[model samples]
Target: MAKITASVYTSHVPAIGAAIDLGKTQEPYWQPLFAGYDFSKEWEKAQKPDVVFLVFNDHATAFSLDMIPTFAIGTAAEYQPADEGWGPRPVPAVHGHPALAAHIAQSVIQDDFDLTIVNKMDVDHGLTVPLSLMFGQPPQSDYRWPCKVIPFAVNVVQYPVPSGNRCFQLGKAIRKAIESFDEDLNVQIWGTGGMSHQLQGPRAGLINKEWDNRFLDRLIAEPAELAKVPHIEYVREAGSEGIELVMWLIARGAMADVAGGPAPKVVYRFFHVPASNTAVGHLILENQPA
Candidate 1:
């Protein structure tokens, strides 16, 4: 059976990549921000999982408010970069693990969780930024990503999003799906978004560094506690519609390893202020006991 080697959490701030490309990550405010991810870069290289199943919310790029899937999984052979309002960020097309993704789809279905499968889709910065942060560009000499990615899009942008408990349950289903895979491959799942901050209307620049850090701390040691938080409360407390942190629960749920344990080992935790109307928080968890 395939094992989930690691679970990581990172903020998908498009400006960060733009900062790196424009030589702004080294700027006084951004230098330390990027520095925080140095260890994550090292860890990813060391683990080098065969496939990364990423969970992120599209920024009205791939799925607009018109039609949205609660949970969408990419079962395609490849995914191209999406064209956001400004333009597409120059990046290599994302490669997918169709066999595994298909297996996950079947597992979720059997487990009674309806999922939307994308055979052909374009990934926006929400997926690519984390990739760029965790793994640098394909290579200086080549223009491709170092690893293959399976995109799992969540609909947190639109209202009536999935509940925290629902996201958590889905994670359990994902773990079962992955464990049933009859292959020998190292797989990693990532849940991206939030710490706290808002990005719409008058609340555009909200920042709660304290709450963000506390959320990270509790997420590692006391997930069930965090899981109890309702979506409306998250929006009210975190910010207007800032409840997207629920998606992180899905990632956390998958890492829970329910058959075994009490808590997962948190290898790394990072929190940064002001990553464009959001507090950039990053975490890495191992399913095995510490």
Candidate 2:
């Protein structure tokens, strides 16, 4: 049977991707930010999985005001990198695991969580940046991402988005779906976006280091309690975009501990500020083997 080996959390800042693509990672401004992911890159190579269940929000790229799915899952055979105003980044296209993805969709929907099944769509930086940070740039000669990815997008851009509690419950349903799959596969769920930096209006460059750190601590030690936090608090304290943190709860909810198993092992944790216009945070938590 398939198993969810771990959950990864991080902020997907576009500028970080630009720095890597432009060969500016070693520069003074970006060096520290990239350094934080050095361990994650190596750790990813060691704990390589057959597929990555990536959770992120599309920033007005694929889904705009025309159509919005509160929760969308990509079951396509492949996904292209999107052109988010500044053109597409020089990155490998993402391959998808269709069989497993279809299974997850069926299982999740039967469990009562509505999901839009996308067969064709372009993936934005929210999805690609996380891949680059954790896997680094692929060689020019061979430019395929390390593993097949299943993109799970949430609608945080629009109002009436899924609450933290709803996302958490859906994750539990995802765990159940993965475990039920008959294939012998390894999977990792990643929650990307957020660490408290606003990018709009007069508060264009707001950063709350204190609130971000406390949130991280609670996420590691008491995620269930953290899930109870309301949307207004995230907006008021962390900023509007800070609501992205709710996606992290989905990944956290799929862990073993949430299902009456042993607590996950925190393999790595990192936090940094001013990555473009956001505070970057990254974490790697491995489920304790049963």
Candidate 3:
């Protein structure tokens, strides 16, 4: 059986990508936004996991508001770049780990979590921003990106989204799916989104840095406890429709052991207030060696 090595969390704010491209990372405001990643960049380079199972939500890019699946897995060979109104963020297309993804699909089925498999689709800033932050645009030629990916997109945009506990359960199930894989490959699961701030109407530009930092501190050391926070509270206090942090529970749940213990610590954490309509909270957690 393959061993699961690391799990990382990232906030995908498209503006951050623009900041990096425009060399604004050194600016006082933008500097702190990317500052938390200093250690994460090094950790990823060292671990060099074979596959990254990214847990992110689609921003009405692939699955329109018409129909949305609570949880969707990409089993395709490749994913295209999505055009988020302005234009496509010129970057190499994302490559998928089909073998591992197929294994996850089967395992998840056996575990009784209904999933929608996407063979062909495009991903927006939700997935690419993190890719650019961590891996940059894929390198030239046939080989690109430091590792392959299995994108597990959660739908958090529409109402009636999955609950925090439900997302956490999915994460636990995902770990089982990965561990049961016959192949001997190193894997990392990433949960993206949230720290507070709303994108719509009057609630826009809301910043709750204090709450964001507190959430980060707890997420690393006591995720199981964090997972218990109710969804209604997330939306109410975090901001209307800002309850998307629940998706992070899925990433946190994947780190929990069957015997039940504290998950891992945040080896690297970055927080940038006011990334467009949201606060960018990026974190990376890896299981401590036994």
Candidate 4:
């Protein structure tokens, strides 16, 4: 049966994508940020997952204010990158795992988590940036992403977003669903978006390094406690947009340690500041054998 091999967490900053696309990664301003991912790219190569279950929030690209699903699962056979003001990023189209995604939806829904099943949607930078960071540039990697993907989008753009505890619980259900699959597949679940930076209003360009690093430390050691962190704290301390960090709990909850299995091995942990007004945080936790 299929099993979750690992959980990954990262900030999906759009400017990082711009730097990679415009051939400015080597520039002084962007060099430090991209360098942090050097080890991550190598790690991805060594741990070639058969499929990646990516959790990210749409940036008004796929779903506008008109309609938003708190939790949406993409069960499409293929996904095209959406044009976010600019033309679409020059990246390979994403091939999805329809069977596994559908199974997960059916199982998770039965588990009491409501999910909107999306058959067709154009993915935005929220999805592609993480892919590019992990798989490298389209030319350097492949015309297609290295592995199949299952896009799981969480709603963080609007008010009344999901709570950290809710996202975390859904993740456990996801783990259960994935493991029940008959296929002997290795899957990696990823939660993308945030390390604290408010995009608009008076707090624009806000960066609470102290809170952000503390958040990381707690996330690695005491996630359940971290999940209890209130939403107002994220807004007041980290910045309004920092609330996105709750999404990380979803991936953390899917790990082995959270399920009474052996603690996951932290293969990588990286944090860098001022990556296009946001702090970039990343982690790779590999589930250990029981």
- Compare candidates 1 and 2 on TM-score and give the better one: 2
- lDDT of the structure predicted as candidate 3: 0.79
Name the 10 consecutive residues with the lowest summed lDDT in model 1.
Answer: 256-265
Best by lDDT: 2
Clashes per candidate (backbone, < 3 Å):
1, 0, 0, 0
Clashing pairs in 2: none
Which candidate model has the greater TM-score, 1 or 3? 1
Question: What is the full ranking by TM-score, best candidate first?
Answer: 2, 4, 1, 3
Q: What are the TM-scores, per candidate, against the unseen true structure?
A: 0.95, 0.98, 0.92, 0.98
Whole-model alpha-carbon lDDT for candidate 1: 0.84
lDDT of 1 by residue, 1-290 (tens): 88787789988877886886676887888988899999999988899888898999888877888899999999999998888876777778898999999999999988999999889888988899999889876665877777778899999887788888889889889988998899987888899877677778777777777777788887787776788888777776677646768888888888745545656778998888877667899999987743
Error of 3 at 110 (Å): 1.6
Per-residue CA lDDT of candidate 3, range 1-290, in tens? 76667777777777887787577888987776676676677677788889889888898889998889889999998888789897787777788999889989999888999999888889888888887777654556744678888888998888888877788888888998888888889888888877686767776667777877888887776667877787776765677645768878887788845327455655776777676677878877767655
Q: 1-290 in candidate 2: lDDT tens per residue?
A: 99999999999998988998899999999999999999999999998899999999999998997899999999999999999998998898999999999999999999999999999999999999999999999998787998999999999988988999999998999999999999988899999999797889888888899999998899889988999999999998898899999999999999989999998999999999889889999999999977
Candidate 4 regions with alpha-carbon error over 4 angstroms: none
**Each model's Cα RMSD:** 1.6, 0.8, 2.1, 1.0
* Residue 52 miss distance in model 1 (angstroms): 0.6
